[model samples]
Target: MLPLSYAIRNLLRSKSRLAQTVGGSALVVLLVMAAVAINQGMSRVLSASGSPNNVILLGTGSEESVQRSEVSENTTGIASASIPGIQEILGVRAVSGEIHFMNYISSDDGSRAQALIRGVSPAILHVHPEVRLTQGRFPAAGEVMVGRLAWRNLGLKQDRLKIGTSITLNDQTLRVVGRFAAPGTVMESEIWAAIGDIRVVAQRETISCVVIRLEDPEDFSEVDLFAKQRLDLELSALRESDYYGRLSEFFSPLRAMIWITVSLIALGAVFGGIHTLYAAFASRVREMGTLQAIGFGRTTLLLSLLQESTLACLTGTLLASTLAMLLLDGLTVPFSIGTFSIEINSTVALIGILSGLLLGIIGVIPPAIRCLKPALPTALRS
Candidate 1:
């Protein structure tokens, strides 16, 4: 077998070509990572936002979005009293009367951006155990608890959403008295305010929806029965998980487009890498023949050449992975409903590395074969 040093020396032989190969490989690897992050991040956000045992009651026509839903203030009482399997937390019914509002909010720095604000009673926390207040307390009237990514989705910096920072909601100025984290979920891109305060400020007299947690997820039929039986209320019931699943389906096309775009560009890079490898190996035919004559054989030389390509690809992937960790991990991307942090976790990194290694092997094959196609005499003479 050819010494591994020979492959390393060949890569070091042409600095310019090596740089081109490595740079191209890095860009392709980065594109693949970005695609994975976007797909997985969106998937995670949707999945984290829902629990199967939870049920949402909204206006009949507004089942698709809570923002458009308007349910009766009495709906919570009706469901909590009538639903047989409702979960009770500390003797309090796990029912949240929430008002969802979206409007342009101005940060303390006077920067304005669109924001999703949730008006909720204290029971919201009881309903959603995932929300943990990292700083300050839950919001009161004239105050708001910013979700960790709320400011980012609003295009404001982290400092603008911190405790004591104030933001304008229409003509009203609401202080950010707290910060909460609901990791991997859309709730992390919302501002929580007291239900009464938002109703007064947003000029809405009706609650948006009533969220109910069930002791048995399968007991959804009871909630459905309530919504069905109450014709005057004009209500509909949806499982929280199914709602987010539909949301995920809605974003599928967008994610597909990202993958398609990345794939096309990566294909171009693959072909370009092939051309580069062909040129690099073609120039080393005489060197390869010398190795073959020394009992290394064509297979040994081919493996050595493959090792060079894989080394360059692996190095480029490492660089791309580093860049992704620094710039993309924890980066918040705002979507239709809210924002989700791009989690560059192990699964994503592993997929990216495997993609790069596969690209290296696949891209090297034709070029490697082409370089060895000629007779030993012909190759050595070239």
Candidate 2:
């Protein structure tokens, strides 16, 4: 068998071809990683929107979004009373009536950006424990707690998020009193305030949604049935996980568009890979023949060619992954599903590696087998 060093030497001998193959594959991997990153980031943000133990009550037929839902104020009282299997801390049941609002916010310079405002009670802090105040106190009535990402993206500092610094909302100015962080969640992109304050500002008479903490996840069916049967409340219950999964439906088409585009680009790259590897093998036909004549088996020639192709693809994968981590880490891309920042995680790394190896194997096999088919005398002619 030909030693591994022989494959290395063969690849090194044709540096330009190797670079072309590697660089092409790298561009392909880069595109694939970027698409997958968007999908992964979206999944992370939407999944993180809900807690594992919580159940949500949305307006009947409000399947896509909480914003579209209308849960009546009176329903909150009935839900708390009638809903069984709710977990409690001390003596209080875990339920919160929340209002969701969106408003335009700006820097002191007047550069405007959109922010989602979640109105909640003190219990909200307990509901979403991931939220941490990095500066100032929790928002008081008439004040807001901006997320860290929101602050950074909007170019506001803690002091800039001043006690009296006001942001216009529905023609009313609301004070910014604090800043918080809820890492890796959609909450990171929002501003939070007292429910009463937002209701007054938005002129809203109804709460947006009701969230209840369940004793166990299995309690979903019971709660869901109860909520759906309550014609008086006109509400429906969704397990938090299922709610997010439904929310993921918003991104499904966008994700499909991305995968389709990636597939087309990968198709081109695969063909390019095949062409490059075939050319590389064709040019080295004499070398392969020489090796075979020297008693290197056909299997050795095949493995050597495969190793070469694999090395090129692997190099491209690493390049793409590194570029994604460094350049696109916190870069947000706007999509109809939801705006998501690219996230590069270990899972993405693994996917990229597998993608590269698959491309290599698919591209090199035909050419490698062709190289091994010719008799040594016939191969030497080339």
- Candidate achieving the largest lDDT: 1
Number of clashes found in candidate 2: 0
The TM-scores, one per candidate, come to 0.92, 0.87
Candidate 1 Cα misplacement greater than 4 A, ranges: 289-297
Worst 10 residues of 2 by lDDT: 151-160
Best by TM-score: 1
The whole-model C-alpha lDDT of candidate 1 against the native structure comes to 0.88
Model 2 off-target regions past 4 Å? 151-165, 328-343
Question: In candidate 2, residue 153 scores what lDDT?
Answer: 48
Q: Write the per-residue lDDT of candidate 1 for residues 1-382, one digit (tens) a residue.
A: 7678977888899999889878888889989998999899899899889989899998999988888998888887887888888889989989999999998888887888889999988899877888899999988889999898887788788898889888989888898888999887899999999998899987887899999998899999999999999999899999999899989998999999998999999999999999988888888778777766676778877898899899888888998999999999988899867898788999889988998898889889999998877888888788
In Å, residue 102's CA in model 1 sits off its true spot by 1.2
